[model samples]
Target chain A: MKTVDARGFSCPEPVLRTRNALKTLPAGEELEVLVETVTSRENVRRFALTQKCEVSFDETEDGFRLIIRKP
Target chain B: MSDRFTRFFASRWGIVLTGAVIGLLASLLQKAGNPPNMGICVACFERDIAGALGLHRAAVVQYIRPEIIAFVLGSTLAALFFREFKPRAGSAPIVRFILGVFAMIGALAFLGCPWRALLRLAGGDLNAIVGLAGLVIGITIGVWFLKQGYTLGRSYPVPASVGWIMPVLMVGLLLLLLFQPQFSEGGAIFFSESGPGSLHAAVWISLGAGLIIGFLAQRTRFCTMGSIRDVILMGDTHLISGVGALVVIAFIVNLIFGQVHFGFAAQPVAHSNHLWNFLGMVLAGLAFALAGGCPGRQLFLSGEGDGDSAVFVLGMITGAAFSHNFSLAGSPDKLVDGALVVGGISTYGQAAVILGILVCLVLGFTLRERFE
Candidate 1:
């Protein structure tokens, strides 16, 4: 699993980072994104889902950890 | 308490309320003595602040507007209270800065930013329709760029103190506003004796309004550019609904205050040049989209410790100086022998707009993740 720690960043940044990281991910590989804001979480999830990646998340103490599997 | 408050603001109605409040306050500010149809213009206010600081010699628009100073301070306070202040930087800072410069140039060419464009419409300036259309078209182009994996790279976290820079500078501006210190009578700082810079709401009232709006906006993440971008990219109307509320409520308030004068000619602080109005906002919209926020949103971001946004704001101030010094800003129409001579950008201003568009296109195309 590859981790893109987007903690403490705002919108577009997190989503953009997630997209960039997903570009190099091979099929069936998993990527995790750590974000500290609900806005970033939703945005990253939406972007991932649009790209046909399977997405799910777990709420952490401060924010959320999104797990994405590239198809 | 804070959790419930945050959740509420995240709800749809909360966002609408935020927009409505902003609309109400903006109209009231105009009625209270701010420039006509310009109660709260981030771009214009920043321009005035730039002139006040002697960044430009435009005497008619020089004042340390308290509202602008309070915006950064208010947002910083709100971010601190909410524990949302996260200082970060290093994401193609130069690109963002250049985008900001072009954004201001484009805005001055139209004599307004996105907020002022909407305000102009609400106050019955028919010229704003063209500007709004241009903004939409520009955002659509940016959306295309985003669809093609456009990115400005990623920002890394920095020390918390780094985030306080903008807030401290804002505080310094507040001090200047309070003291009005002079370095040999208009040699250092400048203030407008007449014109839009001289017209303003009371300082305390303006400060209060700025602080309130900044706080609410920070909490809700309100952004005009984001509203358009989200609608185009995600089919989301959450932010646009807020924008709609702002326009609707402002219109109603303007109607009640007798500020509605429907016309394209002789509108205060506005020109009647349809083509430049459209093209100017087109440049501004594209720059805002590329930079990831509108002027107001950038200020809020700076308040919350985004160094990249701070740099963008500085670029905007500098751009204002450039616009005035180089005669790239638009002029209001004037009555000549009972005929309205349509005002617009100068030849140099037109060229600047074209150059700005080309620069934005180049930046958008060259900064993509993959060139396939």
Candidate 2:
């Protein structure tokens, strides 16, 4: 598993970074995305799903940690 | 560590507090000297700055607003402090610039932006209802475009200097403001002797307000367009709660200051022409949606090194100049026989607005990836 720390970037940036990270993520691998706001968390999940990646997220005390599995 | 403080500001309550503070500060700014119900309008302030720089010849509205300058500088400070200042660009800059141009045209047509719309409604201006309805309609349409997988493409990391452009430009503006220089007598840098341009809070107070707002808005990622977009797209009310708090707190403060005037007619710096008011905001809302943030948000993003957003801000300044030069901006209605008539945009403005809508729809349709 690899992690992308997008905790402070605003909306769409985090999503874009997630997509960039998943580009070379190889099949059947998981990527963890840390985000600081609820909006970023949801936006990243939505964007990841559009890329055909399975996505789930857990609420952290500060924000959220999204687990994306590439298909 | 400052993480605990960061967590609180990022929380639901924290956002609400941020909105509340903005509401209170805006009201006080108005009391101090800003235009009525326009203590913090991004579009109007930017237009004034354009006039001040001789971008347009609108004499009654020429002044380099410190609040505008401080917004970028303040956001730069916050981004640096939080280690969030990542310089990046290359996300369809031309398209974002066009969106910014159209957004300004629409906003000037209505004489307000989304923030001003909310503040107007809070101040008991009934015309805002029509404008806000237009905003919702535009946002809903943009939501549809998003549902269809519209994106402006990806932005990549660039050199740190790229992000410093906006802040440096802001510093230059501040110096020009302080020095009040003239290349020749009555040439270049201009200032309004009367009208809304001359009316403003003390420079220090305005700077303080902009700094506080810039800092909090950066930390919380506060955006008026995003608030409406989130609700329509995902049933998320996280951002709207802050927006709600803004209206509520501002309304209370306005009432305390005796600034609440409820009417469709006779509003300051606004028009009563319902149709243009509605249509103008429709264009602005759509532009905000398609471009990914409102005018103020764009300024904040530029401060943090988003070059795409910086292009959008430049587009807006250019649009303001175009609007006044072409008589496309709306004027307030004349009060006749104790009755206020409707002030509407010029025919050219109407045409520009219609054309802008077409452009936005075209952009929305063309800028999406095929998900197969």
Candidate 3:
């Protein structure tokens, strides 16, 4: 699993970073995106789903950990 | 995010800070000769630009605003820098143009765009509350259409040359400004001697500010309509925060500069009719949402070579003309009481807004894709 820390960043930027990271992501591997804002968390989750990745999330004290498994 | 400055600039707080800086600078511009509480209104500026072009004879709002020209040119530069300039067109051009018209009508009725509304509120104009509410309500209505899968249809690629047309026009407008000929009855341009048309920052300052805003907005995709739409459609608050900061900071700045005199009546470039302010923005907001962007967004899109958005921009210019010519525009310090402003749309504006909204609703229902 590769971790992408998008915490503290505003949206679209985080979403953009996630897309860039996913392009080089290996198939059948897992990725984690950490986001503080619920908006970013939801956006990253939605974006991962759009890319055919299986998505789950863990809400932590700081923010959210979005677990994405590449298809 | 690796670079320290990039990380800082792209951070959430950084966006908020940037928005604050813009608010502060906007206030300074107003103090430095821009219209009160109107440092950078895309609709109003475009309308002024239209007047400068002799598209309309509205003397009060006629000026060749260099900022308007800078916005498109700056965005073009950024687009080329990022290799994101793709020229395309043919997404219901007529509908977009009509929407742009209504958007201007609605804005003129209120005498402000979304950005101006926020600035007005921040400057202690209570009437803006109604306008802001109308905006949210209008956007909420637009979200309903989105839920129904409404779309403006897809755009197709065109020759790259087509993308240069809008920018070329902008350059032409600039050249006309550089060589200001005496104003004749039907000259190439019209320059306002006084009134809101005449109030402006130094040409270089205005252009520089416009250029910076254009480039930053392009890179960040900063849009007032999109911010509200995203909140409704995706529960995203990212852009909204930036907007909130703009309002808050502007309010504080206004206070510091003694521009904060709180009252509903006698606001700069704004009227006292609460109902029209609400309905006018309702019309403008719905039009913006239906058109898929705000006036500023349309300009930015035009900069990036979107022919559809360029058409919309032209439509707005035409609409601004109709607004003044047809008495659809509302005015400050001119209190015409007792239905003087029809249905809160200032006489003819109400009719146009109603018709525009009805068209948008109809288009919303008709443009949806079939699920079967």
Candidate 4:
């Protein structure tokens, strides 16, 4: 499991960064991405599902952490 | 609060400047060729499109506007470059559609949306004052709902393909306009032979202006309703200042260009119905509030790949069709199907605003702020 932090980025940056991170990981590896902004949070969740990855999101003090496991 | 808004605008001058430039260009479009009261009306253009599609038989207001196509395409590019394009849907879409319909209905009844209504007033059409008032009242009501706790629920994730649906449709329409088979005469498409429908800026000019404005507005988050709403709710005046600048600049330009024609006797395509103007905008204001953006904002949002806003934009187009088809739209000849439909829809729209406010109130009181 590797964590890719993207907490300060706005809008699609977080989602795009997460996608980029996910691309490097091998199959069955877990990638953790952190993002701020409600819209971005929702976008990442949706992006995860679209990529056929399993996702679980949890709220943190500063932002949100989306844990994605690529199948 | 004012400082925050000021900072927001200052930090995002590109957006605000783009909005003003779009406004100026739209005015230029009117100067180049468009109806008197409508230089760059989203509702009016959509109505024209509806008529062109044969959804309405209004011969006078049918034209395939290139500016609309430019708006979507420009926004598409911006979203793609910014990587902000994500197409998702199904968050109370039906409600959004309904709101769109009523918003158009109300705007037509008023003879303009918030933008056109303001432009009308600025152009010295005094009747617009009433409509402007109604818009404020309606928005105030919506803000009341916001204070209460009204929510439109949440939009879930959908495929990226969903976002491209509208852009694709726009492309198809453009292709149809360009590759019109000369052999097919009066098949179904309607083009205005005369009247407001016949008047238009050049296709390239319209589209170019739209694309520019779309890009700028997307960056700035400029919204007419949001300007007023922020002022009323939190004493924020950033967006409103921009709007004020727009009005002042437009008025100055109109006067200098000899476009200022005072008195309301026969103001270019606009009627003199006072009460309907007020009531119509009230309906529009509420709908805009509930839906979370004005027609222009919706366009920009759609450009940025918000599928929900795209649906609402379509709803407005469909509503325009219904308005003209059912004779619910106002015409200079008559008062838009008497008072029955106007009164009925106005009442329904107001009721929806109230319901939305009540729901918001309940939610506002009950839902604790997780951050707070």
Which one is best on DockQ?
1
lDDT of 2 by residue, A1-71 (tens): 78988765546557656776888889999999988655477678767776788999887865689999999
Which is superior by lDDT, 2 or 4? 2
lDDT of candidate 4 over B345-370, digit per residue (tens): 34444444344335433433443222
Spell out the clash pairs found in candidate 2. none
Tens-digit lDDT string for candidate 2 (B301-329) = 89888899899999999999999999999
Off by over 4 Å in 4: A1-71, B1-12, B181-184, B333-372
Question: Quick one: best lDDT, which candidate?
Answer: 1
Per-residue CA lDDT of model 3 for B1-372, tens digit only, reads 324543454456756765676677678778878999898788899899888878888888888888889889988987787665877787789988988998998888888999889888888888888998999888888777766656676566679999999989999888888887666756747888888989999888888888887776666566788789878866766667778888998888889899887888767788878878888888889888878787887888899888988999999989999998888888784445633332234557778877877887887788774321
- lDDT by residue (B164-200, candidate 1, tens digit) is 8999999999888889899786485788999999999
The docking quality of candidate 3, as DockQ, is 0.06
List chain A TM-scores, every candidate, in order.
0.96, 0.94, 0.94, 0.92
Off by over 4 Å in 3: A1-71, B1-11, B182-188, B334-345
Q: Write out the backbone clash pairs for model 3.
A: B276-B344, B342-B347
The DockQ figures for the candidates are 0.25, 0.13, 0.06, 0.04
Cα lDDT tens digits, model 1, A1-71, are: 78988776556667767877899999999999999766688678768877899999998875799999999
User: Looking at candidate 2, what is the lDDT of residue B278?
Assistant: 93
For candidate 1, give the docking quality class from DockQ. acceptable
